[model samples]
Target: MTNKPMVSIVCTSYNHGDYIAEAIDSFLMQKTNFEFEILIYDDASTDQSPRVIKQYENNYPSLIKPIYQTQNQYSKGVRVEMFNHNRASGKYIAVCEGDDYWTDPYKLQKQVDYMERHPACSMTVHAADRVLSDKKKVLSRVRPEERNAIFSVERVIEGGGDLIATNSMVYSKEKVKVLAPFYLNAVVGDYPLVILAALHGTVDYLDENMSAYRVGVKGSWTERELATSLKRINHYHDMEKMFDEINEYTEYRYNSALEKAKLGYRFSLLLEQGRFREAKHGEYRKIYLELGAKKRVLLEMKRYFPNVTESIRKARWKLIH
Candidate 1:
């Protein structure tokens, strides 16, 4: 009787036919003695995704179990589908969506070992490399910023670790069950789960880049609109609204507001670019003013004093680029 931890790998696929096989192959290569079951949920894919799932299930019946849906659940929502599929399992959940793949065969083993040793650790996340679709190879290793390697919530928040990479996280069954209710309505489903896990127990940073996240060129959540101010402003506003719903501390709100302000500053570039309508520009200006009070004193000072803002902006430009 093997006493290894049972790891349930959940792979959710929509239209990622091109990437699904490699996703499954990553799991199939796992060298662990633990009972690992791969649950592949095809979310009513119209592409070759169904065929890919069938192929993998046929090849590795011992490790793979494919769940097929007959109709489009797009209206019912992706989050709902994910929660339902995940709730059925009682073991620890390690997520690697069809678009991403685990690179290290010992990824599960390493995490499980750590969690067992450190009973306080609820979740463990490693770093991941980003790959382009056409290239079919890694474009660049998306290394974690110096901050995430350490385990501090403030550092995590300031260093943008709140955007915890989904592929890198390994969730205990208890955490999975706790998060199932919250996952349903969260616009950005992953954030609340991370926050909830942090509340319950510590989330460890595994420092190594052990996974590959395929960044599709035409995906809905790509960073292509970095050049567009209105888009940036809207994105920040959406994040601000999401943050408001968290019932977290004022410090959280303060940090979130600062982030919103920085985004608004970038968004101001659109006004400079003459891309905004007069009314829209006025609204944008109002947003910056509202965010100004919540941000740092320096930013508020910059609001009242343009010459100082210009000098600081020039210094920032020189330093950053």
Candidate 2:
């Protein structure tokens, strides 16, 4: 292996013992014309993830470099990606969380070739299949609408959560270095990173499905069930903070879209807790008005006679089904 690698694959794990091996093996299976290094960080996993990481590190000494943490830095608000990113000597960085794995062997080769040919494209993401961990069933395919299209910063922000898939993303390391504190400190990583990447250059989409995103797994950030009102509120708070940070970092360039997202989350929180009257006031009033007369009437019905509206909804659902 050369001192300078062509791509750096960064994998973060916390209690992903059962799925770490598959993640490692997937990287090992990549067929590329250039050299790449796998930087796997085990964030003080309470499970057997450390042992699995050790096994791979021992077998593939040159390619797999494992960083076993004694204390979980993520809980302390440490950005593991920053550390892995500093150690990366590659021109491109590919991300795949421990619970997720790549399905195609040519994933790296294709991405690298695309980046080389299109220097203006700061990042490239492909389609991925969402799989439920419990039943091992493929739930859905996630990707943007236009295949092989170049997405501008405004377009990416407008696309919202559908712009790119985290595991399917491979971005230019040089462009990624321009990411601000707003992105590094955000609750979630991928969306902000994509936005930051778009600020530097356009982001491209590849139509190929090359990875599996495992959801509904224990300790999985995106998959865990928010079972309480408090938990749901906390989730929205985090999302709101993320949008606020993005707005500030981008110097209010996408203010309108950001405001819409922030208000959308606030409205969802109010609707979840049955605070309909409060939702009709303040910044949320605009969003409430956008709900149309039918939804507004339904909201009033839900506020005054929740049980009746719920019954009607259930009956309607049953009839439709």
lDDT of 2 by residue, 1-321 (tens): 567899999999999999999999999999988899999988899999999999999999999998999998987888877878788889999999998999999999999999999999899999988887735579788867646778877777756665677899899989887668888777778887888888888799899999998866767774343645678788888888888888887789889888877778889899879998899999899889988999999899989998998788667534432
Best by TM-score: 2
What lDDT score is found at residue 36 in candidate 2? 94
Q: What would the per-residue lDDT of candidate 1 be over residues 1-321, giving only the tens digit for each residue?
A: 243338888877777787888888898898885777888887788889999899888888766788888875654655643643454453577888787888899999898888888777777888888776646567676555544453554434333423467788887777545553433545555555665566567878887888887765443243344424466566555555545554343335446543644455445555444444441455466654554555535554554675786687667534432
- Report the Cα lDDT for candidate 2: 0.85
Error at 53, model 1, angstroms: 0.2
What's each prediction's clash count? 0, 0
